[model samples]
Target: MAVYSYSKLETFKSCPLRYKFTYIDRIKRPGEGIEAFMGKRIHEVLEKLYADLQYKKQNSLNELLADYESRWKANWHDNVNIKKEGLTQDNYFEMGRECIRAYYERYQPFNQAITLGLERKVVFFLDPEKRFQMVGYIDRLDQRPDGTYEIHDYKSSNTCPEQTDLDADEQLALYQIALKQAFTDAKDVELVWHYLVFDKEFRSKRTPEQLEDIKRTTIETIMQIEAAKEFEPSESSLCDWCDYPDLCPRRKHFYIIESLPMNEYANETGYTLVNKLAELEDKKKALVKEIDGEIVKIKEALIAYAKAEGVDVIRGATKKAKVKIEEVEKYPYAGTPERKELEALLASAGCLEDVMKASLDLGKLAKAVKSNIWSPELIAHVKKFAVRETECSVTLSKLSERDLILDEEMSY
Candidate 1:
């Protein structure tokens, strides 16, 4: 038996495939793209500013951004496709500087307040069955001489929602819960969702009834995750932020490709393809649009070739068109040349042995695959879990046991 954290538990809750990719396969996500990195960089600068108040010194927003510029840099991309990725660091720094200034101009007027901790890496056990690791470098935690704890999370996202969105977010609840756990001696914990964009703020709370409602839903989510048939997506705008967009079956085209037959490739899965010749009449409108694009492109290309070669071109010319350009994709498991090549590549990369030997947890295997996301920091985060990053929600077949950790003796 091994321990699990709330994030690990939540991974199972959100999507099982992601959990497997993160935990079982031991794959790591590459650094989050530009927007995330910039937000993080700005947060670090603000954290530093608040911390510096201990020395009785304050820097203006321009000075802070200038400091970031003094150390920031940029890069370019030159990769072949499929795995091609890049970042625009100069653009990021400027955005970061702008966000920093706006946040600063809003908060600079407030008194030099008490800061509980900035950039605090807190590890607290909510319960033996629910350990959590919170990396919220809170912007500020002020004590009102009356003794109430405030939890503030910084945001740089566009389109800040109204009270309704705050009422729906689980993070504010989770953060307050974590704050309560961290300051065990404190009596009350209040949460403040601070949106640095357009200088917006909202507060949320759990009345006894509201807390019960949240509890019931959260537990239901946990149960649903434990009984899921697959790693379903959380499914929302959040999908855009996900690093594994292609892996998700929730997206429209990806779903069509996965769940439906393409063109005339029929299967015996009871999902009939072109079974109704009558349906062709219904699709005549769509067919017209398709022909206009696909057929017109070929006709235009041929006309351009005739013009370039000095051959006389004719309007409405009747020409034989190629039906297929190049379309021969092989299955992942079917014993084809493509499959064989992939198997060889996997073997060369040591992934073949891991998969063939079935030495990994199946649930986690269901979660994620990060082909190019293994950074050192991410590796550390994934290894922190006792369970593989995550497992299949519906069924957990692979169970690897760990040694029971012995407790240490106390010094008298």
Candidate 2:
């Protein structure tokens, strides 16, 4: 009975921990970035534009731009952080203005199709049993004279997606399912995306099979999410935009230390103590390596001196070292008669399993599995009796020297 939206499912797919924070735990953050702020403002302007058109009055380009600027200024706040470098708040404001202006000019008079609904909310079941319901808002739904429906979505982003990407869009495809339910007589439904920034429109149509496939995949994804016990944080480039970083285990320490006051951090003697300890440890490692090198040279000298003195043992001031030489035999050729005889004897004694030469090339096997040359069931069967060993190692990377310098500077 989980009702999901496109963004909810996408959030879970991006990072389960983030999804848990937003949906399950419902941890709210203060504010969003300027990009999101601008998108919201533009969406509002567009919604107003369509809403006004329903009243038989079309908003002029200048009027829409004026309204956009007014709303942008009224809603501007300190929490709207501009992430793009060298861009001010005014720059983004003007950019949104241009987007609205361009969109207004492109479809002026607003006579493309009869506006059925503006910013309309649609809900449809993804599963046959009506267990999983997906809800999303269509930016604009229009109808043609031939009973064709178009689901339009507005994108305020600067990036324009490719045709294949538009074709594979799940949001509109899911919306198409809702459209079918809402309009039973809807013969053909077309998915349209208006890239407001680029002022370009992309249209795509989905087959019934495609919608069924999307439903099946969406249900499988939901099943996986329901079956998940541990919501592990997924790291990617998108982490920079994530709002739950302070709560995430992977990023908590960074923010915690970052939030510490410079005076307080400097007053914490443990910080300096740890820094000194790390420096000493690094110096100790170098000294140890040097000492080991000298030991090797001394051992070489001792061996040569012992040979010169024609003695088997060298007596040192504190220790005695002995050099022992033993003769051993090796079979260079595995196909030799001795090796064959040993192999035959071992095979007869049922000990050949210990000496078997077959090696499991795991990398090749993985590639075969990925390429569908080997079935996962077969791999699982082989892995059923597989033994695994865990290896643990300790490593230390020195903290940034700049941070240490900054901390010292702050102390002054």
Candidate 3:
């Protein structure tokens, strides 16, 4: 079995079926988006830049871009989505020029770079007959004074935050682990994510725990992939953002698994209460879902009706409408003194049940209205939106309420 690289592990995690296409089948996807092209181009530039730095060769922006432009053209994959025929010579040059400009502006000012760049595609055949193929590259290795190695990869496109968006990235983690094999003397290795876009750089660091987790997860995933009968697509919100959604079969497999007959639900307790609670919980969730879906449908229809008739139900404080900005407002309704006096008089006369029932009616109206995602049009006609904020209820008297503020404040 071959030792998997950080790239393969990342490919599998991104979308298993897509991963299978590129890595397993070795299909070259066409570059359509600037993001895809720029990332690869940036990688090439960084690899060359750092390689030069390692050997103490000072490289200028023009030279770096020239090298990167050449690499981009040579390594450009024939993506089906790419209208490569339409790309004029001028267009390609302009694209390359813009890419290099962005890169230079981002990195040139930095007097000290932790690591200039890295290259990881260097192939080393271990076996005498070259049967066992092992290919790896240490693009740029930054040896810190503390004797720890900071493994870094360069990227282009829009710069993304490392700590905020890439704190849990497994690619960085796997790279950390892989670097150990390349450098035997380094006792500790640190993973760093560096993104450069339009001359701005964003950096992030990875922990030892995360690096170990990547190693374990990648090994397990690789084993599973090798043993599996098929590589199924993961159908998630991520599917919409994926490039290979049309080719994946994860959704079809879901329907297959859902249709198959299954045994009854089991429990470790083996108690009747467990079964009872399970049944009730499932039923409650289904009912809630149905109610929520229907309510959303109706609300959308109502919004459509209002729009077609050219009537604005929601009156903004100003002349022009707020135009769907997320607004958080505090509303206070003044209590009538006469009404409270009358209610207190009624309570004194032992007619409190009637008043209490009226209050409950208000509650029922709120519950009836509150169900799903709150739309502005739905809140236009009424101030009472059923507020079933998440609450932990042990007993009727022992309740802890947690407000789920979706911004639109309504009582009921």
Candidate 4:
């Protein structure tokens, strides 16, 4: 049985290759950002506060701040990197302290509900078959005097989520199932989040139907992860903070060049060459357009002369030009009399399928066959009556000026 968590499911959705690297391959990287370090320390302080409350002992604000500072100093290490620019390690450390102090002030005396568990681990089966298990830890679980359960989570980030975002939260929704199972009398479970940095609290509830929908969606996501053969990397702004950049095939080159000297990296192989090629390609397209306009004007003059002389073909030094007119049939509307007549005739002749099949884009049909959306038998049937046409295209080449001049002389 595969175990799922909110982070695990979110990781796969954000980038399947990252999930594969973290969960499947079990690649380990050392060190973490200062933000995560601060969050952990704050979570410890909050957990301690609740644990003391469970014992009928209230921790004063000064006592809590003292414990927070002590832990912050004790766990501070060299590997914790600061991600924001122009900020030192002390800035984040103090920021976390301020968040804890604000939280303590807002919810002082800490006796809102009866404490059930601190940093409680909850696990529940998402399906009746019990093939998929969801596991997560609630920051604080409490029961009110009225027997309503509350699942609390703490956030140390500077930004607070919107109300709609909290309403759609999956972690607490999954926890609701565990709460219902653990406490048979549990009713009207509420999801609560403390945005510590902002000293704000958000609450929402999930209906039974919503929880069912979440279960179905989670199971479907897990099945996708199980069936996925190619876990392609998804590049985004978050790649900068990814721990496996050196191991990732898509990002390894970037990390390697980032370590190189600026001048050397700038002149690295194909770096400037590709840029110059792009510039030259743009110039070539502009020149082609100009030359095509001149060619059209010359061709028009030749055709006018040929028509005056009652000639179909005009011979040049090394090539010949001919003027011809073609007649084409148009069916602009489906409700038109001509189109209706054609449709009736085709239906009576039992060739409507052939006409419909012929109207399909051959390239898209071939792609559908390749992707197994359409079977080979269908492709073979279509091939029996399909007509193949070849088209030739010409484009300006990225050659030296001297070589282009020499080629032009040879053409004449």
Candidate 5:
């Protein structure tokens, strides 16, 4: 029954655990990324510009920049995180200022289109029964002289997506749906994204058919969310920007101990254990070559001794080394042309399934299960014969200075 936004849908897609923590549990976390802060500051400036234009008061570039600066300083706090190395708050502030400047210089006098609304709140149903509802705020709504309505979204991010991506974007497109529903003359609606950092504008329009399709897909997504029982965490590079790392099962330990002082961190139990294991592994690898060479020589000598003595077993004080000879068939190595042809022959003979059943690769089966490559029914059928087990592995990598300094300001 909760009113959903584009961000909510996106959060669910990105990380279901995060979605649960945010919208379901309503957990409040202090601090936010500096990138978001800069975007907000830029959005506020643009909102003010459109709002003032409606009141017949046009603000100059300097006035707008001053306003932006004031807002930034007022809202700036110590907890605002800057994740990128070699970037300071001043860099972001200047970037935001430049964004405002670029926008102002490009669209001075503000007359290309009539400003209809600023930070316009839009709520609309994705279904006829009004069951799945979506809400979003348009950065600026404009109606041009030709009666073409434009839903404008402001982006302060440095990277501008390709046109193809914008064409498929759903946020402004959803707002367009709302615009059409609200205004009768909104037939010719355009979705516009102002990439302020790049001083660029991208435009796309959703066809009636596309709108209907999106609604259907969105409703399906909502249904999936509603029916979800286990909201598993999806970890990716984006996890670095996630706010609930401390609550995430995969990241909790790292979150808890990452801020410890070097002395304490070095002595930490898990760290020391992993370090010792890695050290032992390195020593093992270094000795493996020499040991392997000696083992090969001894094995050859043992074989000769066993053949000369006509004995299959050679005994020491308390142990016996058995030399047993057997012939084994070897097929063409996997991925080779011969192997492929052999596979094709077997498949043509209708023996592929039986062969697969005879020597099934559990790794491949597990991968298929994790990737959901099979239907639910097929997965359940296969899962009946499989017992889930946890496999722990340790990989060694030299820690960077940045890793040691992760969340240096994190207290709790």
Candidate 6:
């Protein structure tokens, strides 16, 4: 069995095709997103900060920032892509420095917890069978004086998520499961996230039940990946940062056309076809408006003719039109006061299920009430939601009444 990481699971969820490319085929892509590169440098610096603390040597803020800068310079490559259009390497470099500065100022002494591990590799099984093994590297693990353990993660995201999102986060919570499995003293472990860009700390913990649920769901996802025969691409906002655009079916054409000259790209078959289709669509829209006007007039004349002739059917050359006029039970539209009152009445009467298919299926409810399925009093109460309206509809059919042949001609 392959060792799964949170990142691996996330990749599969984001795009199964990408997952297959990265993990199954193990395709090597050169470029790294600038955001990820900046994050790596920050993690290395923080790891150094805690590693030094373990040696009874506390590095000053300047020393840490200097280390970060050196690492940033050493690892900087031409392939680092800045996806955001206006941002440059210098912009992200400054942002990284600011993140380090904010973190240093907020937690100066760094004595809140005892550093136990830095960039620690933890591998553990999610179940007793040990079939579904998982692996992760903790950025820092610390123990408080009160014997509570903390699994810390360093995040370099440009945007800060809400606390509710943190509560639902699975990365550190999975680490907590690993901690509990690996150590006897892991009863009270906290999941901590250092949102470096925001200079904020978000903490979360998992109940035993929650941990079990996470384990079960994670296994289910693993099984799904193992059983998948066709890894379909899932397009999202993250496609801009994806490395396999040249390989992805959805993005391959765009990737290939990206290097073409403007004139050639504009004249490309696919591009020309799309432009032509759009032009036709615009013309079709104008024509549809004119056609709809003609249809309304014809319908009104047909209804008037049917009423005058006292016949529902009107004949054309090869088609016949059947006009229907009937009283339809109309219910109050959704979100209306009358709809709400009726829903409340149904709830009180314990018949909410009869009306609710997914939401309130007003059509179903209307039929039930109109059919007198409910008591007289209840039906009377539901009447406020009901209004009768005469509706007219016209349907066209073949003029020959019982021509039940599959084809126009009989085969001998």
Top candidate by TM-score: 6
lDDT of 3 by residue, 1-412 (tens): 5656666756676677877877787776444554556566666676666667667776888888788778767866656133345765446556556766666666564335456345654443323454333345555667666676766655553435546666666655555555555567746766555555444444455665665565556556766767766776665664544555445665543344344455322322333466789999999999999998996675565455546766544332222221122232222222655445534543564543532553423433344335422344444333432223332111112111322222235443
**Candidate 6 off by > 4 Å:** 300-412
Q: Estimate each model's TM-score.
A: 0.52, 0.66, 0.48, 0.69, 0.72, 0.77
lDDT of 2 by residue, 1-412 (tens): 7789999999999999999999999998887889899999999999999898888888888888889889988998888877679999988888899888888888887888998988899998987789889999999999977878999999988888999999999999999989888788876999999998898999999999999999999988888888989999998877878897789998876566667898877656666788799999999999999998997777667656756887666544334576543332232235666556544544564544543547333344334434654345644543343344432222223445665666679899
Clashing pairs in 4: none
The digit string of per-residue lDDT tens for model 1 on 1-412 reads 2334456666766667666656565676654655565566667677778778757688876778776665443322232112214534555565567777777887784463466767655444333456223333445665555676666677876667888888777665655555666787556656677676567778776554565465456556555555666664566555555556555555644434555556533553333544465577668978899987996676567556654665443223222222212232222443556556545654565554444434333233223233433344533433333233221111112222221111112222
Best by lDDT: 6
Who is ahead in TM-score, 2 or 5?
5
Off by over 4 Å in 1: 1-14, 74-92, 109-112, 125-139, 208-220, 223-229, 233-235, 246-412
- Deviation in Å, model 1, residue 147 alpha carbon: 2.2
Better of 5 and 6 by lDDT: 6
Tens-place lDDT per residue, model 6, 135-217, is: 99999999999999999999999889999999999888899999998889889999999999989999988999999999999
> Model 1, 385: alpha-carbon shift in Å?
73
Worst 10 residues of 1 by lDDT: 390-399
RMSD of each: 30.9, 16.0, 20.3, 12.1, 16.6, 5.8
Reference-based TM-score, model 6: 0.77
Clashes of 2: 0
Answer with 2 or 3, whichever has the higher lDDT.
2
Q: How close is candidate 2 to the true structure, as a TM-score?
A: 0.66
Any runs in candidate 2 off by more than 4 Å, and if so which? 261-412
The residue-level lDDT of candidate 5 at 234 comes to 99
Error of 5 at 7 (Å): 0.2
Deviation of model 5 at 410, angstroms: 79
Task: Give the local distance difference test score of model 6.
Answer: 0.91
